[model samples]
Target: MESTMNAFPVLETERLILRKVMKTDAASMLTYLSDKDVMEYYGLEPFKTEEEALSEVAWYDEIFTEGTGIRWGITLKGLDKVIGTCGFLNMVKQHSRSQIGYELDKQYWGKGIAREAMEAVLRYGFYEMKLHRIEALIEPPNTASIKLVERNGFMREGLLRDYEFNGKTFDDLYMYSLLRRDYKGELS
Candidate 1:
């Protein structure tokens, strides 16, 4: 049986809403995608133009259609602009696992927005999607991201050396994961 009740779901938290990423969200996405500070540890150069952002939206669309992943646009409750994107990647339905990824606007840093968004999605992954395990691949030096996952009950599995080639150089990342049985969050 398929795990998802709705292949695309609009997940909501107290302060944020995670919905599908649309082409119309390009401008909002560029607000962060083009920020070097936000992309510093993202393993890729900051997006240079709206065209690039549009292409990125298209890529996201394709991934959903292919069932490889689903990316959600994170927005504040009363705002129309997307402050970030978060969701599953490298999803393996048969194995009931997937890797989580996300990027938020620098302006929203220091707030608990990322944690709120991640917690909402994690619930969807474990309960709604019936996933056995959800993993995260984070650059070793990104302490904020590491803490974010750790705070949500993901355990550090190990380090993956030279795991990615980020255009200018290679990078190493830490692997973290949370199993459904190990998750302690409210599973609504």
Candidate 2:
């Protein structure tokens, strides 16, 4: 894994900007993280307080500082408000792989904002980070997420039976991956 230790990278797409999450973005993070609809497949309960949201922002900073992962707060081109977040986590440098995760505000669902942000992140992971593979784990029932990954050139690998315990219960996940070769081929 190439380390992004010096400066956090900010990525931009035609309609979105993927920037570092800050303390000031806590309220905006709360807007979506606290919504039941947005958190439905996210495995965590909807946040009930601003403090919970702050902790999330702190996690984003922690991952970047520790060189374990990077998360970006998603915003529109001319706006400073964060509508969502997306990033790579569980990065294994030795293995040249990382897991991708993302969520959007309910209000922004269907606008392709997540897809736009994901494309930029994917490019960074494969090109800048020099990763060979990026993975996405989605709940079996998250059809929307399944579709998104498929559209982004990810291939379904297999099911991770009872892979995650979301506090109360264990849930199975469908593993999807995009290899560097596949990503490059898509561009061609």
Candidate 3:
């Protein structure tokens, strides 16, 4: 497979930019990671403060250093702050597979920002990273997120019961996947 190790590639859409996540982005990241409403469907609890966001950014850095995952801070064109993040989580190099994930600021909901970012990330994963399959596990009730992946040609695989525990309780997730053969680079 082609080497994506230690590589930080910047991807851009008409209205958004997917760039490497920097420690300096912690303050902007806090805006959404700390918002309960925005994180309701996330498997983990919302970040409690800027320190948490800083730690989260450090975690991201570690994953990148280990070549296990890569995340990009999603920023709107002309905006100085990140509105969200999207990237691979568990990447298996031997299998050419990875699990994709994203979280957006509530204020940017319904603007198709996530969709745009996902498209670029998917393209990078398939064409640039040479990944064979990219998967997403989303909360069952998150219709918006499900639709976003479906629109990108990700096929619904199955439900993973008790797939994740959000501290208080277990939750099910709908698994979705997109294969390299299925991607035609269409982002509409």
Candidate 4:
């Protein structure tokens, strides 16, 4: 894999900075991704070790340079310490779309940090990447995530039955999307 430093650069927001995931972040990031609650909606099992988290972030490092995906570390404005991971996954360049995913440490939930980070990723996807659409597929039971996506103007497209994750069958995934036209009127 080639370096993605040029394809994905650091993106800044009002109170946060969405930057590339770094090796140093693995220790802090594992705390969140390894939590059971955080992985509840996610298809894969909770990460059991820092090496596992580091492996995932290393994948992001390669994707960043390839212009195939943009996975960012969600950090606060004043701190270099990472509190979460948020960004696009499974980027399909030819189709001009990708799946968006995010997860923060439990402590950061309900503080509107997820929403803020999402809005920023949307901007990067729509405006910077020139993508035609961005979407989120969440398990139906994850009500908070469902609400967060809706709050950001991503329409509830439909429920896809039996989405696969981690070799287990998922009953349904609520699909949400935001088109360029949809955002043109709503982003204001």
Candidate 5:
């Protein structure tokens, strides 16, 4: 089923809620975006202010409005506080593809939260979005992210040498992808 533009999708898993990010979520977003450890492989420098976090929230809105992508604030099933964000970006409708990105608060790391959240997003990308392919561009040294995607059935295609400019310098990123067929065959 393809998603319509009318409503921002809210995804649910066993223990989490992936909902549209709102202005009110800025402070929660700041918790992780401001942490150097979380931002290390994220390409951008740590956000230093709530204003920056607010701007990040605005960007999330802009992307969804423009039909470029959608980002969901990750929260526990019973809580309103966002613990992280995950979603698709750089979506190309004609190609039926998009790149996925995600990050969690440092305190929540290694708890399998990211993985559970990611599995829900992957389902949305493949089934709801009707995407043919979903990709992840991860910094090579980010073993945690690598393992997350790998566990979700994405395969490391290869390294994209000097592929992105992370503000200060060009960085190498590994390209990981899962095709619809592969996702269905392995994960369905």
Candidate 6:
């Protein structure tokens, strides 16, 4: 039996095992979340300890317990290493839609891990949770993230001026979204 963060359901992809996060993943999770380049546009500060990472994992679990959203830690299949995380945030149940966010270790970025993880989460949202729309907001300077979101079939809706912060300065973000029909090729 698998205990998921959101308890929604677990998903697997060719290169990743999408599962509930455990306190045990703190060390590995810190490797990614603690990086300046990795968290720069994601609007998070670098976590310096397993304790910090573990606390995050605990908070991540609340989305499930509270019945609001779902999130997963991305683990490699063969190595069972936590490389990154992806999930829905600020879910509005009546709207049947939610915001999405994800970040991977800089080491994992170009190897297609981000896309694999994105695909897995999207499936979980649309199929298991019955969400009609899933969206991501990317800070403009993060070109790699922009490409990744595009590769996953999320269309750019528009730019939201000064959408977020990096603890110092505000940054603009481009809004992207994919509807269930868009995911299934029913939308053009």
Give the alpha-carbon lDDT of every model: 0.89, 0.91, 0.88, 0.82, 0.89, 0.81
Against the true structure, what is each candidate's TM-score? 0.95, 0.96, 0.95, 0.91, 0.95, 0.90
Model 6 lDDT per residue over 43-122, tens place: 87788888889888988888767666667888889887788888887787878888998888898768988888888888
Model 2, span 1-188: residue lDDT tens: 77656888888888998999999999999999999999999999999999999999899988898888999999998999999999999998889999999999999999999998899899888878889999999999999999999999999999999999898999999999999988953231
Instruction: Give the TM-score comparing model 1 with the true structure, all chains together.
Output: 0.95
Estimate candidate 2's RMSD in Å: 1.6
lDDT of 3 by residue, 26-143 (tens): 9999989888888899877888888889898998888787778899999998996888999997899999999999999999999889988998999888877888999999898999
Clashing pairs in 1: none
- Candidate 6 CA-lDDT value: 0.81
Instruction: Name the weakest run of 10 consecutive residues (lDDT summed) in model 3.
Output: 1-10
Best by TM-score: 2
**lDDT of each residue in 1-188, candidate 1, tens digit only:** 15333557899888998998888999989989999989998877999999999998998887777777888999999997899999988889999999999999999998999999999989888887788999999998899999999999999999999999999788999999999999998959
Give the winner by TM-score: 1 or 2.
Answer: 2
- lDDT for position 97 in model 5: 92
| CA error at residue 160 for candidate 3, angstroms | 0.6
Better of 2 and 4 by TM-score: 2
lDDT of 3 at 150: 93
Best by lDDT: 2
Off by over 4 Å in 5: 1-4, 184-188
* Stretches of model 2 off by over 4 angstroms after superposition: 184-188
